[model samples]
Target: MTASLQGQMMDMPLTVSALLAHAARFYGTVEIVSRRIEGDWHRYTYRECERRAKRLAQALIALGVEPGERVATFAWNGYRHLETYYGTAGFGAVCHTINPRLFPEQIAFIINHAQDRYVLFDITFAPLVDRLAPQCPQVRGWIALTDDAHRPDMRTPVSSYETLLAPHDGAFDWPRIDERSASYLCYTSGTTGHPKGALYTHRSTVLHAYGAALPNALGLSARDVVMPVVPMFHVNAWGIPHAGPLAGAKLVLPGKDLDGRSLYELMEAERVTFSAGVPTVWLGLLAYMKEAGARFSSLERMVIGGSACPPAMLRAFEDDYGVEVIHAWGMTEMSPLGSLVKLTGEERRRPPAEQRKLREKQGRAGFGVEMKIVGDGGRELPWDGVTFGDLHVRGPCVIDRYYRTDTSPLIDGWFPTGDVATLDADGCLHITDRSKDVIKSGGEWISSIDLENIAVAHPAVAEAACIALAHPRWNERPLLVVVKRPDAQVTREELLAFYADKVVKWWIPDDVVFVDELPHTATGKLQKLTLREQWRDHVPPSARGDADCPLTDVSTDLNADHAGCVPPSDRATRSPP
Candidate 1:
């Protein structure tokens, strides 16, 4: 290679703006498609996306969005969200993605906590904005990201996003971003106290996008029509929005509506080769496809995360519908990418069942990531499948702290993910416990995952969430909440008895509450803390495994036990979802 070319490659500081420059110059005509609003599709080339993103930058700058300022976006996976990804960061501002799934109060708290200066939100969230605007402090401007979906002529002033860029030059001179400048911030899926922010750099985001598109990562390319079902407000849609451009891939944005029908219709119509979402979204789509007696002919693979990917779900998609479900895991601290379960050269030749089993693990750490398990005393533990410990990761992309904020939980430069995991001989990581969700009983740690997995194993159970309660004898005990399937009858005792052969005697949940539905977080994770707050005090005295038992509806009983939003504890008294 020429000396000048080699120096250029070596000295190049990878940044989101730099990636856009490359894509804009090299592959401008590559398509970036999206299902705008719902049921409707819009197509824009990568060049156009970059151009519009530049206009957006011009608009932000014209609106006085200074460097180091926080620009918040309350949006889903869509074109506007994608534009904000580049536009905000392209001009050296931080994009604070407010999770639409977070409760309105939490949403308000995050906006206030981040001290966002300007807000750009999808029209679908206007009601939430109306409810939350009073609490937001730093916000001086609000831009509505819609043409008609959720717009209204309100007395409060908010400019239209697209209209703001109407007069601005589509040609933009992207600022030379500083390496240390914070490019984006996505809060953790806070199951505990207030959500902690993980600040990502222009460098880290660029590197992450590169890693995500590698064959060993999400394996993206220009030919693939990609849809990131993971919300845009969450970890840059798992980094696919930028990754698509960096890798020259076609992107499909499923705007605000992520229902199964909408997603499936888009997938088939767009000929989406790859997609990613949580298990709940995939499970819903699979169910919908099966009900309609249809499947995607062009659909290839899906990367599942934000939660565990069940072995059965993966197997069904592969065998029944011919889709490969790759399980990936990461945290907000780690630029949202820790590992992907891509098969190796040797593993690819393995039997289908064996390959499926290996893919179910969280997979090994990626190129830029470092992993170690720390035991109770904080010593580094070995990667033995049986020895589950607190998983700690440190890397270039991993955040050292929240930007311009104090969250005491961040420890020792390594963000405590509050997740417990086990790594096997092959470097495959399997999540065994979520820190708070793990039940500690009689001095032994119990994986609530074990209980929840077993609970879901019951044919009649639709969903299950297990939480710990303070017990007089043991430090804490477990309570299981079962959401029954449609027209299915499952007594608490029957459900508990189903777990007899699965887990150890002492590890079984002490109480099973048969509610119509289990509480879920915005990301579709079971909200165990909510369950703990409801059922922690009053224990169901009756044993759950007995076959000959009368099912008492605990909905009324639990309401009497607690004055507030009580979790339905009655075995037969399922509440409306």
Candidate 2:
């Protein structure tokens, strides 16, 4: 005999449209604010946002966009971009957010590969659109994300977003879309090869939004004022767009202005209670606050992602500014929400020193995320808190295959995350290094992330990176590259002594090299590949054992006038990024 399950439940589809509908129905008066590209504040309510989004949907249908077709957007984090997100995906069209920070050729390649039918962009990107339109022949039209008054002249036939929505009266009916239908498409930054698309479905996105709002994650709510400094083009701004509406939080978008002063002014004016961005943005803000003697009155929680948050940074915020720093980790392939570094009740009960140790990790996986580590030959590694291995994850939001690719990127239903990490029995995860960034010296593996973090903790060092260089005795050795803070005077011996107390001697970098600046990715990740190539030929002093070779004295004073003592062979080519 078969047991029957309850059948009285309502069949509501878990689509993005449903989220916006819920916001409009329950929190119609919730404010959605935007600092427009025109250098002014634009305010609206959830009800108005839904109305405009519906009108935009009608405009898209009038433009001949069909179900499953792709509509690309080149804009920042603003109200118009948010409208594009809901408008395209609400009526069944896939919203493809393009990263305008990528090289022009990469942009052209992505547009052509996605086969986008129409491109909607902000006025700031109109010149870029004009240059890339001729290369993408499949694009049928372009729409500027602004009023006609602020539209820029372009070679392609362009229409203002205001004009497109003005003809409709919010009368369009949204079709019942399958929850598994594709809703959004984003590409990886392509550090190694060509960029690959990660397509996300309506169910995955909505579920991710729900998981993000969990108390262990962002903890979003109706009373919070949220600001997302991460661009909307990057992994849906780490899923803030959907989570904000789902939780009915007031959103403040900074359009085309990400300077420290600008962000601080906006946050102070709006009384932002929660904000999310990369570490570089936060570093700039910390510098601004220090320079101007400012403080955060309303901001209680700050989510730092896109890269690891250094322990020094975490200390700076919590110890000095009275802010709770939530260190997060994710990727474009994971719907961009993997884990958040939050303390558990048991962990928080420990001494303050022990709590700081726990906060140094990337943290346990968020709700709906499953993670494990595997060694060579696909052997499962024990969660002993010390055994590092290849990181793999599986969840409702993780991608199984890249877009338009016939090959699957999974092994036995788990996706390899291309990171080397360790997990403890308590479910805490520590990211040691990326798979490619790990250095193999002699027979031991060295974590560049550890060295970089320790170096940046020095009062004189502003930023740091570690890369592998050729060695005579060891197959490779770690080299520290650094940028000094203004008026900093620290010797190599001082830094080495600092590390002697913190790490094993073998783990310390063999030599220290100072640079005016380090190369960084558009997302603020250190460009180790470029750094490796630039210094591949430099002969380390350890390999040569030549005391005569020009080397910076460990006892010499470091000042702005000091030209770095470089080896004779490499002196000519050494320059800034």
Candidate 3:
């Protein structure tokens, strides 16, 4: 094959509309399986999925959900979720994925904000639906994604999802919408503030789906039994839902439960080879693997992201089970994929210990993505490993603006990711910390991650979390919270001094508290926002810029001196929100 032919647009497809058509026409028998509502296996094929999706398109049009109108889905990963994806977009209506994890108030606000006309939610969220129904006025239609056999008593005027399509002829010509037509919308994780919607175009979604299935991306195929543990309401389920069918992979849906036992059962029964989820999910899987002495006979990979995976967890997967952990990093803005950590052939041949270090760092940027590190002055930094700066990215899938936000902070054509990172000489991305999570003292930024990592190195710590608190003198200072191991005892001075050989003395946290446990989000990363809120009310006399003034709101006192203060028992070596 010539180079010209390889990159040529000729003889190639233009959009996801083509992908679905091809999957239905040529790869019709490919299975798209889901867990049954009656607690058994449900089996179907791509041809049926496509036919139903088209019928759904016809139904949307019949109901007068106009082109460019939004239809929301509050669902788990299942065949119906897959149907809505193609069905909504096929009709030129945007599929707005409303995360069930969001607060009920936030859910109502988003439904109102997005002006979603219909909601197709899984039976699992029935109670939350009942509670929020009275407030969500824009949702004129409510449909439960369940069969008559599994239907629960619902307070709303609901229809069975299957029944919604039962009478339709199961055929509709997809609209010839522009590739740039909006396809799907996913709101950001709302912990920091109100959720802002990110609208993805058909062009962007199709390109991302293609890129994600490449040899290095997820290496998917019709042969690989794929199950994405990531939630569909978040970042297109890490873009797996579309990628799987596009690659002709036998997609498996782990509806509702993601606990270790359920995952193992699904993987073993389905012979699932490729899987993806955040680190916390893997930790649960790892615990189950050990406790049950379970091992997969056909599994190959475990893609981890949303937060950094610890070296220990990474080690356990590769060393014990022969499963590769691909540590990926990105934000909601970057189609949620910027850097994926997988070693090049040359690096893989190195000593196992040496390779571990490289695998732990975020991998090189993917084919279509470009990355840069910029200092606080917004000056682009060198790619040399030593220079650390904010991570900015640009790509076909990366969003230029949040659809719901009035003022977008994305700068100069690049999305300003709040992460502090470095592009090493080898092109690997090393995440140091979040820009706000780093402590700046005497005009120098100290990585809370580096401090926390060094603290966890001491065997006495079960988990260590680091945060910056207000200092009277230094603009910001470090705080370390540690949950000690049952038989181990560690103190503030001892832990601070432990970093003596590793990091600069001034960089260590001033206080170390032993907390009984740490707070975490539903997604499993340490809840720094909750921690910041709790201590946001605290101020010491020395660090108080206002001098003995009480801190009613630490967020308002951003300019306060953080010269002296430290963290209490934290959950990990790195807890960047």
Candidate 4:
């Protein structure tokens, strides 16, 4: 028997630099629009961006930055910041996008941990650098992403961004660094201990970008004008920085001003066709549009992630503005593009009500991402769509370990996403709640996300958060904290009654508390941990469901020790919360 010979093919490496080079070569004339901090649109071409990127790369080399050395950037989404991304990673240096929203101490710690040699930031963050520079002694120089006239006077000697690049003609050839070399570093927003870094390689980034460009994912193309309202500091703005160029999509970068009016103006002016951001930003846009009685003339799709997209927001975008809403789910560890909610042909043919139900889910896993649910016994759960389990993901882009940490977070080669979810037989993923945020009542698990989503759907409620509060008998019960719409009056009884018709009696919150606004993290996720701490001593108003409650139709015998029963306090800590 003769062995079959493998087909000879070009061994082109999948690297970010290659992605940019391909764009510059094929789509050089494609427009790249950016809203500058000066409240003006800064326009350029992919060719110009690529040339400037090379110039910036040369500038990095001139600054004594070596290959594999970390260069940190604390800037908003704009042309200069985008250039920094390409320049740093395209030239084989690690681009660590530090989240300026983090505490000063955290910024210092991350910069020091990454051993960043140069810190480049926007003019807005000059004050921040001035305050944190004293602590980050490892950073040799500070490069401001501004002109000489706009540069802030700081204690540390600062370099002008344009001046640094003036010497380079962008004629230098890009080196072929190993595809496995470190390219990007992003730190998880640590809820427990200190933030842990996730180091990504060029291969993983390129692969993730490819995944993001797939039609089932971001649906990027050369004709699309893409805008990412998500901060560049967060998961490379959900990998749009690379995916845009890979697909040759015209890119639009919204700078520091991310409010509804500002975003709408930029989107209208740039004629952006696709955009991605958290649900909160979209909510703001919705509010602004409603007030002005305007519609998105060009936007075709909006991707909502960072947190679950409210059903109302999804409906508002589609029903009111004729824009399709794509709900996405991901974390910093998975090159941040895990699953996007896109309907199949068969699903799309269904009735609007049925389709909306499917849209509420986080959607099916992307091509490269594999997802499974695991039980407490370390066994894989069935994809029945009803049984919830710990969501575990394995993919080419998923993180195997934290940067600089010896501990491996993988369990049997699968990275636990810390999310409790269910996967249907059709492979659609429904994220019920985060593992830590799941509220345990008696022996049953009540999904906080489900409750919050339901509560926010109320017209009077602007936002809502469900946190587990200490209970004497049930051990822990859900407390619904709501922020009412302006001038809206909603009684506690009214809200509880509203839930009675939707969820089971056991799943409803014991009481409702109104606040001016619920707290949110830097990335716009509901900070349930802080809420849990703030309402630690909360007292439930009652346990028994109301007589008119919809749950009265179901079995309610508490003595049966059912999963929904409010058991005594002894079994409170029996299992992980």
Top candidate by TM-score: 4
Return the candidate ranking by TM-score, descending: 4, 2, 1, 3
Model 1, span 461-529: residue lDDT tens? 767888886765456667788888778898877876787687655566667788877778877787777
**lDDT of each residue in 236-328, candidate 4, tens digit only:** 999999999999999989899888999999899889999999988888888899889988899999899999998988988999899999999
State the number of backbone clashes in model 1: 3
**On a 0 to 100 scale, what is the lDDT of residue 437 in model 4?**
90
For residue 510, model 1's alpha carbon misses the true position, in angstroms, by: 3.2
TM-score for every candidate vs. truth? 0.88, 0.93, 0.87, 0.95
**156-264: candidate 3 lDDT, tens digit per residue:** 7788887778779885787677888898988887777778888999888888888888887777888888999898887888889888888888888988888999999
Segments of candidate 2 deviating more than 4 angstroms: 1-8, 546-577
C-alpha lDDT score of every prediction, in listed order: 0.78, 0.87, 0.79, 0.87
Model 4 scores worst on lDDT over the 10 consecutive residues at: 568-577
Quickly count the clashes in candidate 2. Answer: 0
Candidate 4 regions with alpha-carbon error over 4 angstroms: 1-7, 543-556, 559-577
Q: What is the TM-score (0 to 1) of candidate 3?
A: 0.87
Candidate 2: residue 400 lDDT (0-100): 90
Greater lDDT among 1 and 2 belongs to 2
Among all windows of ten consecutive residues in candidate 3, which has the lowest summed lDDT?
568-577
